[model samples]
Target: MAEVSAEARIEAPAEKVWAQLTDFTAYGEWNATHTSFPNGGPDTLETGATFVENMKLMGFPAEVTWTVEELETTRVLAIRGKGPMGVNVGTRYALAADGAATTVRIDGEFTGAAVSLMAGKLKDSATAALNESLRKLAGLVT
Candidate 1:
């Protein structure tokens, strides 16, 4: 299995950050990596909720069916999904209060053939994308 994690501290309250992050319908508004996410909208965020997300990764269009695996009000959200790559991918978002800011962390992992062949490259790309998304989220919340 290959794992990739990235974190950022935003100058915003945890509630504000959580609201923006969990609002699935508006993901395309600030998430640079997502081109379109026309699935269950914001209502499809509870545990076991399923949706399809269309994203551009490394300039390629990729679509994945994702299910919310876990959710905790303003602290954590985790999603798991699979695509044609045959990998079970897990994406997690964690939030913590830091003084007057909110620290957000994103972690992802791939457990299948596609990631084993390109683990290093995938890790690098995931890190960069996570950082970019954090920057955009910060801008949106602040």
Candidate 2:
């Protein structure tokens, strides 16, 4: 298993950040990592809400089937997914509010036969990608 985490402070309120982050249906509009996502959005951020997303990782096209594993409004959101290349992954988003600013933290893990072989590179790439995504998200919400 390999774990990676990244954090960023956005110049936006917690409500604004939460709205953007939970709106997974429109992820392709702001998130550069996702090329395509399912049209049907999750009913709510609760365990069992399901969806699929097509994204690019390490310059490779990947599609993942995901289900919400845990969620708490404006606080925590976690999703687990599986994909090709023997991938099992989970992503958690944690948010904290400081008056007008919001701090967003992303923690992700990948565990599988192939992941063990490329854990180091995958971790680095995932960190970079999360940072870039946060920057882009800040622009969209703020």
Q: Write the per-residue lDDT of candidate 2 for residues 26-109, one digit (tens) a residue.
A: 676666668887556676668899888888988889988899988889889999999897899899989999889999998999
Any idea how many clashes model 1 has? 0
lDDT of 1 by residue, 77-107 (tens): 9999886678787999999999889999999
Off-target runs (Cα >4 Å) in candidate 1 are none
TM-score of structure candidate 1: 0.92
On a 0 to 100 scale, what is the lDDT of residue 41 in model 2? 61
How far off is residue 95 in model 1, in Å?
0.4
Off by over 4 Å in 2: none
